[model samples]
Target: MDKIVSFCKRRGFVYQSSEIYGGIRSSYDYGPLGVELKKNIKDEWWRRLVHMRDDVVGVDSAIIQHPRVWEASGHTATFNDMLVESRTSGRRYRADHLIEEATEIDAEGLSAEEMTKVIREDERIKDPVDGGRDFTEARPFNLMFETYTGPVKGPENLAFLRPETAQGIFTNFKNVLDTSRVKVPFGIAQQGKSFRNEITPGNFIFRTREFEQMEMEFFVEPGTDEEWHETWIQERWDWYTGLGMDPENLRVYEHPPEKLSHYSKRTVDIEYDFPFAGWSELEGVANRTDYDLSRHAEFSGQKLEYIDQGTGNRFVPYVIEPAAGADRVALAFIVDAYREEELEGESDDSRVVLKLHPRIAPVKAAVFPLTKKEPVSTKARELYNDLRGDYSIFYDETGAIGRRYRRQDEIGTPFCVTVDFDTLEDDQVTIRDRDTMQQERVPISEVRERLQRLISTGSAAAER
Candidate 1:
């Protein structure tokens, strides 16, 4: 995790937000390469979830919504984390997290009283700072970030930065149904920013106050909800593994009945083996049993039900929600792709490479000139410009060719195209594969086509 974090900052993938002002805690700004990689991941998700499916449609909702929307969705009253403060350091921490860190126990669903009892009884649970055992009683801290609307600061004008994108989709369900051809068993997909006032937001981008979510609410008839839930679980699992995630490092964790959310009849998490936290949720697929629509219908006095045209049956559609943190998944990809390999001939030398899937790699290919000479530099620049329209191409002519290749490797550029003196006569350039370090000569015109094929095929053939 440390290595990946350092690599991200060093290679212009990510940087701490407000670094010039001593940085904000847990806040990050995606740099040049980071933005590209993150966008590729979101694009791939949208491609599969919305563009490829007849049953799914997309929506972009505002970050702020009517306060009553959250109230209707149960987030206002129920969305909270148990917080306990250390008397010694005056620092606040999530009580469940404190218990988890102390005993390696899954304490998430435990009540504040129960967590307090555990903390009091366990002598090993000391303050993370100063090592003092004195602490405050556990209490619920609402995760929503509250703000005012329209220059008003009164209670009636209060609004919240949405804690999740699922509510946005829920509130727009009727609108989507009326506007689109979608019916029951179809999904409303959304990808957007969500905010939560996390008590202890850490673990890099895994848990942050602000994050982006790729969420889908698949509404189906009551009787069919279970089967759809299972289907989405499998679909989400395949997505991670299909994108080159190791199956061994991934697992499905079922939420016990007692731990289920208020809206969830059943919930299962797709957890990735994070280097820092072991197996943790990369995404969640939940069976929301008509709770959302029913609540919204009752609260807003709107009809949020599906009418079966053939049978004349009217019922609230059960929702199958698959919610994922975009930032978390991006971090997982970076962690999974990181590699440090010893050079074959030089035992003392090694190369750090990111074996990212070509389709999601920040730079698809880099164009390099063998030297600063006229013809080579000009040819490389021309090739770089030609491919820029089709892909994210990098042009580097600063250092030795080997050093240049190493720079590209560090940032997960899949291929490096080198224009040398031979290109002046042969009209061919050398293409080097990041992983194999193997080179092949191809006509300048064929370079684009070759990259297209490689990117389409991916670094290695991954089953989709």
Candidate 2:
């Protein structure tokens, strides 16, 4: 974890928000490298889910909605976490989290009374902050952020910021259907920001107050839901693997009957092994049935039915939802790819490298000149400019040739192109592979094609 944090900061991957003014807790700002990496991840998701598929369309929905929406969704009454206030130190904590941290046990589905009893009656618990002896009674804390529409600041204009992106898709289902002329067995994919007032929003960007979600609601015919649900589960599973996430570090956990959401008939979470948090959810693929559309239709008094063209059947469509936190997935990529290897015959020359797959690496390849002299630097910059339009290219002329290779290697640049004096006579450049450190001399005319093939197929066979 420390290695990742230090590498991210040193390489300008991510930074603390408002650091000059003592920084905001649990809030993060993406640096240059981080922004590019995040954009690649998001673009890959859109390409695979929405662009590549004929059945999935996309929509952008508003961030705020009417208060009644929450009521119909059961969030007003049930979407809450148990919390407790420390009597001695006057600090508040999520009751379940405190219990779990102190006793090293999970209290996920426990009721408020159960959490309170566990905190107060359990004698093995102790506070890490002040060495406090006991805990206060537990209470429920609602996480919605309330705001007003008009200037009056009254309940009449009261609305809430969305806690998840799926609700927006539900509210806009009819709009999409009417415009796109899509039938049942289709989907609406979305990528947007959502907010939650979390009590303990630590662990970097894992559980932030404001974050982005990439989600899809695959609406299907009623009786076909179970099959489509399983199909989408496997499809999404394959999508992650295609993006180069290690299969060994990823697993699916089926939600138990008691652990499922109120509307979810079935649920499975894709968990990733992070350095600090072990196995935590990176995405949730659930069979949400028709719960979202039904609730919204009942509350808003709108007909959200899809009529079958062939059978003339009119009914609501069941939804198979795949929800992923963008930040969590990005952080997982960094954690999974980070590596520090000891160099041969040297104690202090150990190397740090990120073995990121080329598809999502921030810089696809770096171009370096063996010498910083007049013609070498000029020629290298020209090549850098040419490749910059097609790919993210790194140009370094200030360091030794070997040092430049190490710098590019640390950030997982797949290949490094070194311009040497031989290029002046032969019209060719030497390419060094990051993983193997093998150098090959290739003509300048073929370099672009070789890079394109390698970046596309991720194969050293391109060099053949």
Candidate 3:
């Protein structure tokens, strides 16, 4: 876990937020390469969930909605964690987490009083900041971030930063139905920022106060919801595996009846073998039995039901939601791609590489000049200019060719193009594959087409 975190910082993937001011705990800023990688992940999600499928449509909802939206979604009342503050360090933590970390107990459904009692009785349950057992009684702490709109600070002006993007899709359900030609079995997909006042946000970007989510709510007939739920579960699993994630490191965990959320009739989480936290939830697919629309309709005095034009039957559609954290998925990909390989003949000589999927790699390919001299550098820059418009291409002339390749490998660039003296005569440049370490000489004019094919196929030697 520490190795992954260090690599992320060293390779310009992520940086602590407000680092110049001593940084903020659990807050991080995506650097240049990080932003590109994240954008690629989101783009691939959008491509598969919205563009590739005809049943799913995309929506961009606001981060801040009306206060009543939370009330209607039951988030204002139920979206809370059991919090306890330490008397010695004055630090706060989730009571359930504190207890579970100290003992071999499943603290999923424990009440505030139960958690408080466990903390008071257990000697191992000490504050993380300071080794003190003194703590306040556990209480429910709402995770929503409350704010005031306009210039007033009253109940009427109260608003909340959305804790999940799913609610926005629900609130705009009627609007989408009226505006688009989508039918009953269609889906509404959204990707946006969400905020939560997390008491124990840690494990780098695995859990954070502010993060992005890629959520899709598929509306279907009530009777067919169970089947659709399983369908989506398999769909999500296939998505991860299809993108090169090892199937052995992924599993599906079904929520027991007692552990189910209020709105979820049946839920299954897609768990990943994270380096820090083993088999943690990377995404959840839930069968929401029309609870969201029913609640919204009851609260807003509006009918959120769908009427089948062919059968003339009116009923509220059940929802199957696939919710995934964008940051968590990116982190999983990074962790899965990390590798340290020893050189063939050189003892104690090694190189670290990220074998990311070509589509998800931050830079598709890098352009390198053999030397900082005139003709080679000019040729490399020209090739770089030509490819930059189509892909995220890197141009580096400050380092040795071997060092340049290592730099691109560390940052997960799938291919590297080198312009050498031979290129001045043969009009061909050497393209090296990061994973296989195999080189191919292709005409300079064919570089873009070759990269396009390799990236699209996610193969090092697709044409070969």
Candidate 4:
């Protein structure tokens, strides 16, 4: 865990948000390389979920919605985490998480009192600060961050930063139905920032007060809700593994019947093996049996039902929701793709690489010159510019080619193109594969088409 965090900071992937002022708690800023990686993951998700699927379309919702939207969605009344603080350390924590840390025991189904009782009863659990015995009582803390709307600050004008993106889709259900050509079995996909006042936000980017989410709510007929829910779970699992995630490290955890959310008839989480937290959720698939749309209809005085054209029957559509945290997915991709290999003859430094998928790598390829001198550098610049129009590329001529390759490898650039003196004689240059460390000579004119073909085939044949 420490190694991954340090690598992220040193490689310009992520940094503390307010580092100059000694930093902020659990707040982080994605650096240049980090931003590119995030964008690629998001683009791939949108490409598969929205662009490729005819039954699904995309929506970018506002960060702040009418306060009533939350009320109708039941977030205002029940969105909370059990918070407990230590008297000696003055540090607060989510009771369930703290309990999990203390006893390798999952406290998900336990109530606040139960969590407090378990912590107090267990002799192994002690105050983290100075190992003191004193602790504070557990209480429910609402996770919503509230603010005033318009020009005034009062209860009448209260608003909240959206805690989830699903509500926005629910509120716009009628708007989309009235305007679009989509039908009952269609889906509304969204990707946006969501906020929660987390009691304890730690573990790098795992749990934070602010984060991005990629969610899709598939509305289906009541009888078909369970089947659609199962289908989405498999589809989402395949999405992650298809993008180079290790299938062994990903699993579906079924939610206990008693622990399911109020809106969920059945829920299952797609969990990944995280470095610090072992197995944790990467996404959740839930069967919300008309709870959201039905609630909104009653609260907003608008009918939120879908009409079947063939049967002429009007009914509320049950929802199958697959909600994933963008931050978790990005972090998982980095951690899962990271590798360190020993150099057979070198004792000084080991080779570190991020074996990311070709389609989702931050920089698809890097262009370099074998020497910084003329013709080599000039040709490298020309090739870099030519490929820039097609793929995100890196061009370097500063240091040793080996060092440059390491730099690009650490950032998950799959292929490196080097323009050498040989290229000046024949229109051919050396293209090196990151994974296999094999080199192939190809005509300069075919570089673009070759790269396109390699990406389409996932990775170059030589990379194997």
Better of 1 and 3 by TM-score: 3
Clashing pairs in 4: none
Which ranges of candidate 3 are over 4 A from the true structure? Answer: 345-348, 461-464
Model 4 earns a TM-score of: 0.96
Order of candidate numbers by lDDT, starting with the best: 3, 1, 4, 2
TM-scores, all candidates, are 0.96, 0.95, 0.97, 0.96
Return the number of clashes found in candidate 1.
0
lDDT by residue (tens digit), candidate 3, 1-464: 78888899988999999999999999999999999999999999999999999999989999989788889899999999999999999999899889988899888999999998899998999988889999999999999999989998998899999999998999899999999999989999999999999998999999999999999999999899998998999999998888888899999998999999999999999999986899899999999899999999998999999999999999999999999999999999999999999878633377888988899999999999999998989999999998988878889988668888888888999999999999999999999999888999999999999889999887766545
Q: Each prediction's Cα RMSD?
A: 1.9, 1.9, 1.5, 1.7
Give the TM-score (vs. native) of candidate 3: 0.97
- For model 1, how does the per-residue alpha-carbon lDDT over 111-169 read when each residue is reduced to its tens digit? 88999999988998999888999989999999999999987789889899999999889
Q: Candidate 1 vs candidate 2: which has greater TM-score? A: 1
Worst window of 10 by summed lDDT in candidate 2? 455-464
- Candidate 4 regions exceeding 4 Å error are 104-106, 345-349, 462-464
With a 3 Å backbone cut-off (N, CA, C), the pairs that clash in candidate 1 are none
Give stretches of model 2 more than 4 Å off: 345-349, 459-464
